[model samples]
Target: MDVTTRIGVVMNGVTGRMGYRQHLLRSVLAIREQGGVPLSDGRRVLLEPVLVGRGATKLRELARRHDVEHWSTDLDTVLGDPRWQVYFDAQLTSVRHKAVVAAIEAGKHLYTEKPVAETARQVVELARLADAAGLRHGVVHDKLFLPGLLKLKRLVDAGFFGRVLSVRGEFGYWVFEGDGQSAQRPSWNYRKQDGGGVVVDMFCHWNYVLENLFGRVRAVTAKAVTHIPRRWDERGEPYEATADDAAYGIFELDGGIIAQVNSSWAVRVHRDELVEFQVDGTEGSAVAGLWGCRVQHRSMTPKPVWNPDVPTTERFRDQWAEVPDNAVFDNGFKAQWEQFIRSVAGDGEHPYDFYAGARGIRLAEAGLRSSAEGRRVELEEIAP
Candidate 1:
């Protein structure tokens, strides 16, 4: 029989969409279902999440639903408690810095959502603080854990594509223009002051994806556009859209791989999900979606001349085939949470730590600057 390691979780922003869905329901409660993570030394890692939020009623409801007894509206009280060694933050982008800095000062190992801060300087400062405190840290780069992305990684590792050439990412969805009666997303997402915008939100994912699958971005040139100027809120009131609705950026990776990422809030997605990546190499290529991957390759270097008159069948349109789902894990976000818990238990390393998170934020910051200046921006310029 293994003894269980008691872990007290200080979870902030429990009421937010990502916080509740990924952290509360999937990570903490789902781990309970597996009887906790069993260790080889006859010990188990038990997660006890102490929900922290502003609303007492919602916290109480969440606690009751999860059969968790601990809930608190006072963050100071929770942080002062020595029993809790890990502090998790999923607050809005604007509040992430303060919450994380406080957690670090309290000497708790930290895990939080992406875009560590709005600027590269803040991210670097946080990383420095975490290192000085000697606390373990991780950030949510959940896209890497997606089954499709994981499969792409496997292909890359196996050298299926002899020499990687380029990568493309497409992410977007139709955002409702706020009319008098339209149901709009939270207003903050459309306002620059609120840290709401697709560039900041989605580019962080692109950074991790490019870093993990391809390489680090050395420089970037981008163009951002605000396609819609007005939108209606859920309250039947109109608000001005002040943020960019679409962003197109080209990245030069470390090894000469040119990567392009397109992010938009106003584009209509014909696919079930609005994210996909395509990788091209000298010998082969692969296209990955949320559910699966398809591969195309030249078995022996077959050459073909450009022919506009050729039919779709002659262009190897059907050459691509679906790769089997090799993952037996839960959702990507849940997998990341489980890993974070395991790492906190001193069993292994957390893959996306604070440094990685900072890098993503730096890339995003550079993207914004490039769009604003209408020129190329070097990663070294924003390098912490």
Candidate 2:
């Protein structure tokens, strides 16, 4: 695979966890090591990712460790370079709007993490700017590329569900208190001032999952709670947690489908997977997790009569059949990156653009409003 042409990408915030592990190391650099991504006509698209961040020490160590040749602390210098065609942002959600806007203005294609901006208005503005600038852009909708969800989507497309009645999503894991156990997440995640909250974080993911797998979300009724009031910061200083630790939401989607999601940083894991969606339909039911999906057809579904007098012997978990993992699955983020690169190369089209990102933030905003007002909030699309 001797490829002559290459696509230079400016990747900001690559020193962070998601940026470093998922975007930089696994996706971009991995593609680089593989020579290039193959196209249908026996062509290859080479990716050259330049790491950009604030700290030189972190950048130096990261670049050295990951075999990255280019590293820069000044973002403006990187953006000004004509070689870099794409600007990928994985920075803090608060800072992404300005950086992405700058990239769009620079005539660079854009790709970034979820919640493109802290507000839905900002997302719409960015989308409009990208469109006006005639630059192609995409946002991370990594969940859609996951193997389990793909299987579930296949069931829906094959009409195995008949008619979806409702969907139940359980997504959460215990984040250790900074008292004696070190917190797994960044310290800023518990602070509202830093743009942290369960509803804002999780609902963005749920929005696409619901819309893609079931239907478009129309309204939401939500309740949020800050279960932990005080927590230790990165420096071991105690601080008041201003953001919501947990959020329970009920969504009304098109076709009268009901979707319920419970997102928390306080709940312990007791299920088969960290995140699971149990979808009930008229003809059958299926439960899809992060990597696996199980289905129980109506014919195979057991019927249990209400009987308190006699001890039950029927095993519930044994009835469902596991969806076969017949295909090799790649990392979800990498899967999306390949498609985005193909789209950027003018070899394909991508739909998960800024408009999709705006839709995600729109749902998050509606969930927050519903929780605050104690009423159902209807989604209103913004025209920018």
Candidate 3:
């Protein structure tokens, strides 16, 4: 027989797409279905989720639909409860700060979605609060845990990309402008007042990906634009799209590596995946996306002559070899949840802590600043 310890987690903002699909359904419920997370001492830690949100009807429906035992509309009441030891936030960026502050004051361990707060300052403050309160805290860095990126990381660790030179990343897809067609994203995503923009949303992911795999970003030069100026809201009402739908950024890393990434919600993707990164090095180069990775070594690289009147004759994409998935990978959200649960259960601390979250926000702020001023911005150390 195995001993099981049930840990309660206050899950906020599960009504949203990512929150509902990834965090609630795919992660917590899936973890529960799998007989809980196993511990080293032959003990298992089960996650008991208490769904918390502003909408009572929606929360109740979701709770009942998923067979969740606890559901609450009152965050204050939920925070005061001793049963829930962990607080997980996937709320809107604008309102995240206050809710997280309240949760921290309640002495709950924190786990949150990216861009932890609207600004870098708020994230640092939260980090300090969690640190002072002696609470374990972590932020979502799901991209790094993807199988493709995991393989990329393995190659890096094995010195496959010797003397890394540069990295190029493309991420985006066409989002419908709710006029004749319905917008896939919420109307808030097009409004700057709502803390929405490609820079704010995607830069955080890029920052972590770059730093964790390559090096820390030292400086950034970026241009952000609202390609789709006019858009209709969810209610079929016309409104000015105040947020930038597209952003192009060039980052200078600590190791003199240059990384260029283009993020856009208005552009159509031509690649195999929605997001792809090509890392070029002296030894070899690799292109990795959410699910696939292909590599081309320096020795195997093909050379083509540039001619104005000649037709190109090369299977360029097919030249690269596909990387194999040697091991099974769990859902990224679930994996992170398990790790956070283990941390809260007295295991070692989670590496993607509040400080790491702050750094991601710092990069986002820097990118926005660079775009606004039309000048390259250098990253400065932020402290609480």
Candidate 4:
């Protein structure tokens, strides 16, 4: 029998939506259900997280729910303890940098949600700090771990799609307006001051997905709009929408593979989910949803005409066929968390290190600047 690696985790922001559902419940406790991650060295990774937050009662409740006896409101005290090897942050985007920097200064491995910082410079600094400290660091780029995206990556690597030409990403859903009679998300999500907005929140996903599956973006031109001028809050009080709800951007990848990403918090879709990606290559094309992937090829191109006046049945409507499922894994977030643990144990490479995460933040910063200036922003222009 092999000994288990004792990992003490400082889990900040465990009471939030993502913190509770994804990190605490699904990733940590759920991974425990599967006997945790088995390392190649015959050691199992055991997570011992100390839930940290300002509210003592909330922290206690969360710790009890997860069967973790360790809890703390003082981040300094937790960081001072050598037992805690990793400091994980799932707090609001704006506060991530300071907390992460403090952890790094304390010589602890670090993992946190995406957008390492609200700005590119902050991300660069964080990257520099991590590198200087020689600590293992990673950011949550969970989309790449999605079963659908992984399938797409495999197909792309296999040349199932000859020379890749273009990619299209569609992401959106109907966000409830905080009218007096409706449920609304936290107000911070909609206010720029609170690090809220669809562009900042989601563009990180698109940046990593594009960089991983397609290529690194060399440039970007974007347009942003605030579709709904006002929305209701949890208090049923209407607040003016100050952030952009929709963003359309064109990305020039390294190899000239052009891609477009459309992100919104205000759109209706009939598809299985609001997030989907379609890639076109020389030999074949593929579309992926949360559940599966569909592929189409030159050999399967539907016979059609270029006449718009013809009936709707005149184009390549049925050319695509679903790619069979081949993955045997848990949720994407959970998988990432498991991998992070392995990486921290020195068993594998840190999945999405600070540099990769900084790149995503840089891309988002570029897009926002481009949208505001109505011009294309070159990746090189933004320092990472």
Task: Tell me the tens digit of each residue's lDDT in model 2 across 1-384.
Answer: 555469999999998999999998889988888878777667888998889999999999988988778999988889999999999999999899889988987889999999899988888888998989888889898888788899999899999999999999999999987989988887788888998988888898999899888888989999998998989988888899999989999999899999999999999999999899999999999999999999999998888998999999988889899999888988889889889988888888988888888889998888888889999999986544
Error of 3 at 162 (Å): 0.6
Worst 10 residues of 2 by lDDT: 1-10
Candidates 1 and 2: which is better by TM-score?
A: 2
The number of clashing residue pairs in each candidate reads 4, 0, 0, 1
Would you give me the overall lDDT of model 1?
0.83
Of the pair 3 and 4, which is ahead by lDDT? Answer: 3
Using TM-score as the measure, what is the rank order of every candidate, best first? Answer: 3, 2, 4, 1
lDDT tens per residue, model 1, 1-384: 538888888999989888998878887788877878666566788887899999999999989987988999999899999988899998887988998899999999988888878776787788789879988888898888887888899899999888999998888888777563354467678888889877888888898899888888889898887898887766767788888879999999988999998999888897545688889999789888776788887584446677888764454545687778865847788778778878888888876887788788788778889999999999873332
What TM-score does each of the candidates earn?
A: 0.94, 0.97, 0.97, 0.96
Model 1 segments more than 4 A misplaced: 40-42, 180-184, 271-273, 300-316, 381-384
Give me candidate 3's TM-score against the actual structure.
0.97
- The better candidate by TM-score, 3 or 4, is 3
Highest lDDT: which candidate? Answer: 3
When sorted by lDDT, best at the front, the candidate numbers are 3, 2, 4, 1
lDDT of 1 at 240: 85
